[model samples]
Target: MTKKICWAAAIYPILGLLGGLYYRELTKAEHFAGDTQLSIVHTRLLALGTLVFLIVLVLDKVFTLSATRSFAPFFWVYHAGMLVHGTLTVLGRESGAAIAGIRKPADAKA
Candidate 1:
């Protein structure tokens, strides 16, 4: 449980950073002048994803929450939600690309 929580804490911040980069580059490439859903995705991942796991880690340390039978299922379900959100964000980009021609960050010129 400690290991799992630590991994989530580490992975989420990375995802948040990538989401931030994705938002910036994709918007710039598309010449999008208005606010975008992608713009807030990073903050969401950082705030919700990282923070929740940290709190869960501390609680597990104190309460041994993982000793309970339900903990495993709950953990998987919770992480699944985060993955689904990330997947949806990427899907949004793909659909938006079809309409407005979004470019990849790597393909953008320096």
Candidate 2:
């Protein structure tokens, strides 16, 4: 389980690279408009992904969560949620749709 956590943490750099690419694209665009969603994607991938992985690492080291059977399923489910949410965010950003009807009230009016 520790090995799995380490392997999963390895993905942080890749996500960071993707975020950097998104930032560059945002900067190069002629208009700063309609880039909010893209920025959200970049921020979510970098912040959530990295922070979650780090927390997992700390928890595993401090609490030995990897040794428990119950934790295995929870770990997978958490990561799966992250992947699903990240994919949906990217798609929603591209299509300008609210993901799972989750949007601010102001956004709904627009």
Candidate 3:
């Protein structure tokens, strides 16, 4: 579905930008001068979500990818996966923030 692919490409950049803004503002508000999983969320969504769909769009033009039955399932599953991953990344950034007091990814290694 060209419409579906176009929508995915269009929507993901918005989501990515929102993620970037959220990470920056939240970290500043908390005075969190440290590495965070949130830092990667924006890029990950841009690349895996938007960029991947754009690739699919190009391929669709040449190969009529939407004619296949698998396209619908793939479109839905891929979006869901990216959405869940972004959500979890955001959630995990604050994990253990309460009891352990700011356990960053780097802090866990030592």
Query: Highest TM-score, which number?
Result: 3
| Candidate 1, position 55, lDDT | 91
TM-score of 1: 0.54
Worst 10 residues of 2 by lDDT: 92-101
lDDT of 1: 0.69
- How do the residues 63-91 of candidate 1 rate in per-residue lDDT, one tens digit apiece? 99989999899877754443443344544
Q: Give the runs in model 3 whose Cα sits over 4 Å from its true position.
A: 21-39, 82-110
Candidate 2 structure quality by residue, lDDT tens digits, 1-110:
87787776777668767766865564455344432334554555567666877788899999998888898787665434434444444444333333333544334655
The parts of candidate 1 lying over 4 Å away from their true place are 23-38, 79-110
TM, every model: 0.54, 0.49, 0.56
RMSD, one per candidate, in order: 10.0, 5.3, 6.6
Best by lDDT: 3
Candidate 3 clashes: the total is 0
